[model samples]
Target chain A: MYHLISDIIRQSEENECVFWEIVQQADADERGVSKEESFETMRKMYQAMREADEHYDPKVRSASGMAGGAGQLLHEYNETGENICGDFVGKVMEKAIKMGESNACMHRIVAAPTAGSCGVIPAVFLVAEEMLHLSEDQMVEAMYVSAGIGSVIAENASLAGASGGCQAEIGSASAMAAGGLAYLQGGDAGQIADAAAFALKNMLGLACDPVGGLVEVPCIKRNVAGAVNALTSAQLAMAGIKSAIPADEVIDAMRRIGNEMPSNIKETSLGGLATSPTAQKRIV
Target chain B: MNIFDVVGPVMVGPSSSHTAGAVRIGYIARKLLAEQPRKVQINLYGSFLATGEGHGTKKAIVAGLLGMQTDDERIPMAFELAKQQGVDVSFGEANLKDAHPNTAQLILQGISGQTIEVVGQSVGGSRINIASIDGIETNFSGDYPTLVVHNQDGPGYVSAVSTLLTEQGINIAYMQLYRSNRGGDAVMVAECDQEVPQHVMERLKQVDGIGKVTYLGMMGDE
Candidate 1:
């Protein structure tokens, strides 16, 4: 029914349906499956994300030997009440890192938009589960919101770091998470679209230069930034802040910037943080 | 973009382009070969050459040749699997003009002694584009039911091939016919909205002036 965020919002308002409901019906129609079946497929994807977290092995190191244990360390820091970001944010950071680390360790992950940015969505889901006590069904509904936002980004811009830089990977994930989090908090479709726009604007032009072309370095840690950006953007939108740029315009700008970006900085690992002295030495 | 495309293709990963997409390229190569791979030569290019090893690109591609899916936990053990499965695999670098950085050219020999050259690129997010097959230029996402026909450049050939699909009630979503030079050699690439069944493909092989007929359906364990 809708491919653009503006269209989706307009459809939601005109039809007097919730954001996820429109997406649910549309996805069902597109996939040629029943609404229940379509929703169940999304539920299964959420289940995989949850299970990935449940199966986290703290001792597991990525093949490059640089990714491991930060999640556990953050968990310990949070338990001691030393985290300055507050409990909910700390929990999200922890979960985000865990998910990113798991992906780097060659474990399975839902590449929400893309794999390097996989942790952002699940971080929001797992943390919201802990702090908000939302039901599994509530969480899955939020995923449709994310998916709607994600599809728009993937279409107008791209979901690949190689094609669109880290902005497309982390920025798209953050925007999706922001929109979904807004939905989770009972925000209207307009608010959801605004939240996504705000989140993506904040992340536009971010580079995708992984050190040694590995996902373990700056790649995994960037997940926290994406998750927190989502959290803050959602909070801002829910509190009545409006994005100056429309969601579609923001996505269009993202595509242009991705095209303008030098390929060396777009996941080729030839520049940016990938070329830092410390990163070079740390490359395994 | 399907929302499902946004949500998943849940896969084994360190890098989607290098690892997961590589697996798909290999799987497509295996499918294009039409039988178990007997021996395969893989030529990695650009970024695939620079960073693919760190991302398990080699192992992932081998796993795919073994008919493994992207999420198969056995991906890391693809080398051992190849040894046991009797698929001789070798990797080398490639220099191709105007190719994507994440490209690989697989020259494969299948168990039935059929050989094919498949060049594919891992665009992103475990999605791949089959850029060419058997050195004939054609483009199709392995996601669709694709028919590639290599034939002599002549009249009635394109009509003949498309007519066969039309007769089978298949809709052609995209169709292209290219010739090396006027009346020299030609290729036809057709991506269908529905599967163009085995019997139709067998019939395609019978068309006059046709040198090769290849079909790619969908990715599955079988």
Candidate 2:
């Protein structure tokens, strides 16, 4: 029953189990269910995430008629031979856009932390599984790892854009995805925490200013950015780079920054890019 | 927090707080009414009022009142479905004080001429809080099998309800009682560890001074 990432790490080292196993066991104990039952629930969630990612229809526009076809456009661009990010990164970006666009179109999606930032973890996990040929069991374990990181952040900081900003929404999702990716690559618990810390630190004050108070404009593109950031952070952690500040302290800083933020920069759609003339013109 | 709170609650959504959570608030209000409402007045507040239409908050609420789950793909067509079902629905804005941004006040009139007024808030991430019932202040998250009993604020009502639940082996996880005035109308909100059987509800309704008994099983519990 660890409420903090630091505690989960310490307990993992003490029990001589990987981070996912520790999380699995702790989840069973907390919910008073068997470990097998807990794993079964995660399996269902993973299946849902996979279904959303695979069933993308880029032609479906948001109900607000704000975002549509961008995911299809990105996929087409990636199919061309002129892409610079290579096939692996391109695939990651494609899945992220698909997930975000799917959410905007009112398709079923797992709120990996939240719906506005739902694309980050699924994008990282699905792309990693395809490129690395990981099994279903491995993907499920990675979800457990991601859940552990998200629980800590949600307890220590805020995950709602209304309470914090985009830094709390997409920022937390990026951190969770980074840590999960590190675990899937066989990094230690400390390295996983480091990856999360780096990813969160990089997005400390990103504002939440969805144009027209809708989750379609900057929110969709931001999911793609979060996925890429998670991949980079995981790679750095695997290479033994350490964050100067610990993971828990980084979450505390996020909470502090969220508290200091003005409500306009939160989910109110009053400031930042939401106030730009281009964004304001679409309010009608 | 459990793993589901982090990685799950599969829902159809452009926004969880606005769409999914709105569905839950409406669903719970329907349950509290104990029947399908003949007419409903939904008052969206704060962020729900400012941006609800674009996010389909109204449709989500109507879908929930029709007993649809959060992930039901039929949500987008809920307004039309309500018309087919003969459910009169109207939307308006409310100035709720000190409530969460995503709040809705539902006024439902049931077929039996009984009315229920519920104030619910979508805190975030598909979680909801039933902030008040009628004019009485109360609090309970709709995560458990809950029983809300409206009765006269006289002696022995709480004991009577708790005693019946105990006889059925239902353990109360949390309980709160709120009243408008002394010896006047009161409500008891009990969240139980296990499901309260239909017989228990019928038995409670038969108790002296008990006006209405509402059982809201966990979301999707039906």
Candidate 2 lDDT tens digits, B23-85: 999898988887878999999898898899888899999899988889898998999999998
State which docking tier applies to candidate 2: high
Residue A230 local lDDT, model 2: 97
lDDT of 1 by residue, A1-284 (tens): 78798888888888898889888989988889999999899999999999888878889887777889999998899999989999899989999999999888778888897888999999997889778889999999999999999988877898888889989999999999999999888899989999999999999999998889888778889999999999999999999998999899999999999999999998878899899999888875
Off by over 4 Å in 1: A79-81, A244-249, A252-263, B181-185
lDDT by residue for model 2 (A27-116), tens:
999999999999999999999999999889867988778877888998899989567988878888888888999998888999988898
Ten-residue stretch with the least lDDT total in model 2 chain A: A81-90
Find the 10 residues in a row with the least total lDDT in model 2 chain B: B213-222
The candidate that achieves the highest lDDT relative to the unseen native structure: 2
DockQ of candidates 1 onward, in order?
A: 0.67, 0.80
Best by TM-score: 2
Instruction: Report the alpha-carbon TM-score of model 2 versus the true structure.
Output: 0.96
